[model samples]
Target: MTTFDDREKAFENMFAHDQEMQFRIQARRNRLLGEWAAAKMGLTPEETDAYAKAVVQADFEEAGDEDVIRKLMGDMTQAGIDIDEAGVRAALDEQQVIARRMFIEAQ
Candidate 1:
């Protein structure tokens, strides 16, 4: 049987691990978004790197995932890309699926 202190330590470790995993997932998503935005912008190799970093920065600085999605959708619309909310949601969901698969594979 575990003591209260032991249980508390276990919970703390679990929380830390979970937080680390979430951070890694967010970083991966940011990198992927950066790459996609760079390609869409037709940036040169050097420019692509810079553009990608900007995209990731924009994503992190947003209020939340929804805000980031809205910004992306609005930008695409302004560029005549013809995407809607449902489309953006679907894309984000698909990306999440891909990220999960990649995480599993890495393990």
Candidate 2:
């Protein structure tokens, strides 16, 4: 292939890799947040794993963080956890940072 074609392929591969990494990071972050909330709510190990998986899936419901936040807030309130929206958001942000670090370090 020509140099231009090789460069185009390289760019496409980079874009695809970046997109996959973002998805992995977001899912990991969501699972981390879910585990934190689960521990706060006193769930057992099995329950926590299930809840964490649910949280990861919850992220796919929409384009942004709102879906995860809404699910977490509702679940926490129902379980009598004394967490607010701000707290959930803060945890989400923190998990995102941790996730990014974890992903980068793994690379």
For candidate 2, the TM-score is 0.94
lDDT of each: 0.69, 0.97
Clashes of each: 0, 0
Any residue pairs clashing in model 2, and if so which? none
> Which regions in candidate 2 have their CA more than 4 angstroms from the true location?
none
Candidate 2, residues 12-66, lDDT tens digits: the string is 9999999999999999999999999999999999999999999999999999999
The C-alpha TM-scores of every prediction are: 0.74, 0.94
lDDT of 1 by residue, 1-107 (tens): 56988999999999999988876776566566656655665668897787556656767675567756766677677766766788777766676666667776898
Superposed on all Cα atoms, the candidates' RMSDs to the truth, in angstroms, are: 2.6, 1.2
